[model samples]
Target: MSAEIMPYVVAGAMAGGFINGLAGFGTALFALGFFLVVLPPFQAVAMLVVLSVITGLQGLWIVRAAIRQNTRRLARFLLPGLAGIPIGVMILSVIDASTLKIVVASMLLLYGGYFTLRARLPRFERATPFWDMLVGFLGGILGGAASLSGALPMMWCTLRPWPKQETRAVLQPFNVAVLAVTTILLALKGAYTRETLIYLAIAIPAALLAAQIGITVFKRLSDTAFRRLLILMTFVSGLVLMLRAVL
Candidate 1:
């Protein structure tokens, strides 16, 4: 990459990494704005998945205990989500991705805005494995169809009263897994040219450091605060998605 573009690469990495560390997701939503400014859509996306997965590993280690405790719960969401990915990819040939993004973004704005303004988040203490599975499956479908894997799952998780670690245990790993698959698919499609690798070298370290800073802030937050943050992020993420699709 030229020196002219290096700033965008570093800026994208830090923005993406900080949010991922803070919330255990959202590397793409935050990073793409900087990236699309200097790089093509395909190359920008290629770098994002790689950054997300690498930075996500740090988040995974932080939530390891919660993950071990709720392995079954995670699997209920993950396995079905994985199964839905290929089908979502198939749907891509037939669907208008931009339109689908708008629909999902509108739902996010409606749900996120309403709940964010309220005094409290909704609760679902019951362990509904079936619903969890359904959300995971659809999250995977969205991931495949429009690169929106986290939208559904984040919305679902914010409803509950789970501790921050438990919530991160679900959201962090789910995003990493989906994005890992995306990275592989992109690799097969030759998205990772030599130039992409050069950009990744500079981006990765910046992303890692930013993620650590985000994790520090995340660690200090109360459970309620974290959930509120996620809700607020949902609203923000939806707005970002809507703008990217429209403009």
Candidate 2:
């Protein structure tokens, strides 16, 4: 890579890492933009999955106890999400990814905008294993098709009043699992060449350090604030998503 490209790589790593550490998801969504500027689409995505999973391990550790305590709940989201991945991959053959991203981003914008204007956050206190699974399944499909696995879950989890750690436990591991599968598939196709490994070496440390900073900020937020942060992120992410698709 040229020296001109180095800044964008570092910027993407830091951006993706910080978001992953703070929110337990969205590394690819935030990082991919910077990467796509200088890297091929396939190479950007290949590196993204790796960076996402590697940095996401820190998030998993942050909520390790909550994860253990809520394994069953996590499964409700994860197993379905995993099942949907191949289908999502299949969808890519028949559908236009930019169109899908635009549609979803529009929904996110509206959802985040409408809720932000309301005084109270929407709360769903009832146990809804069915809904959780559905969200996870759809999220997986999106992840597979558009590398957007976290979007649906991020929307759904904000409706619940789970503590920050508990929410991270779900979002963090779900993303890691989905992206891990992607990483494997990409590896099988030989996406990781020597050049890619060189970029990974440059990216991993930048991401790890940035993520640690995001974790510090995450630890300081109250439950309500954290939920609000997710809500705000949904809006920002949607805007960014739309721009990426359109541009």
Candidate 3:
């Protein structure tokens, strides 16, 4: 790898890592968005996955908390979710760039709109097994397409009856396992090449360092403020993605 490109990779990873650590996901989405401006979509996706694995591993420490809270529930929810990963990766292997970008941008817009207008909606807090499966499938599909596996699920899970700590905890292990499985599948599909690996080597540690800062910042914020910020970021990110795709 040329030293010339190393700084850019590190900078991108650092920004991605901070966002992921603050919000539990978005590193890959952000990184891919940035990289796509400079590289081919496949190469961008490959680079995103590499960094996701690093961020996932770095954030895996949150799993201990989940295990302590509700090992049985986590096992049940995450195991089914894990089973969807390979299928998701298979989907990714065949999807073209325009199709993926359109679909992902549309989803972001819809989810962002929903969150933006959430307060005006009727109260509905029922969680059926079907809902879990649906979310798992959507997470897998989106994860494969755009590495957005947990963003939607995170919001939904947090709104569930589960404790805040437990909800957040479950996400890390589930995400790490998903990334691990998908990474192998992506490699098998020829997504990750030597050049991507070199970029990843530079990006991973930078992401981890920024993630530490994000964690500290996240911990300091109030729940209300966090929720508001999450919605705002989602809205802005959705707009950015939509504009990127349309333009």
The top-ranked prediction according to TM-score is: 1
Q: TM-score of predicted model 1?
A: 0.99
RMSD (Cα, Å) of candidate 3?
3.4
- State which candidate has the highest lDDT: 1
Clashes of 3: 0
Over 1-247, each residue of candidate 2 has an lDDT whose tens digit, in order, gives 7999999999999999998888887888789889988999999989999999999999899899999999999999999999999999999999999999999999899888877777899888999999999999999999889888989999999999999889888999999999999999999999999999999999999999999999999999999999998898899889988897898
1 versus 3: better TM-score goes to: 1
RMSD of each: 0.6, 1.1, 3.4
TM-score of each: 0.99, 0.96, 0.78
Q: Please report the TM-score between candidate 3 and the true structure.
A: 0.78
Off by over 4 Å in 2: none
Model 3, 64-103: lDDT tens per residue?
6666767765665576777666676677778764567666
- Higher-ranked by lDDT: 1 or 2: 1
lDDT, candidate 3, at 228? 54
What does the lDDT come to for candidate 3? 0.67
Distance from true position, residue 55, model 1, in Å?
0.4
How high is the CA lDDT of each candidate model?
A: 0.95, 0.93, 0.67
Per-residue error (Å), model 3, residue 57 = 2.5
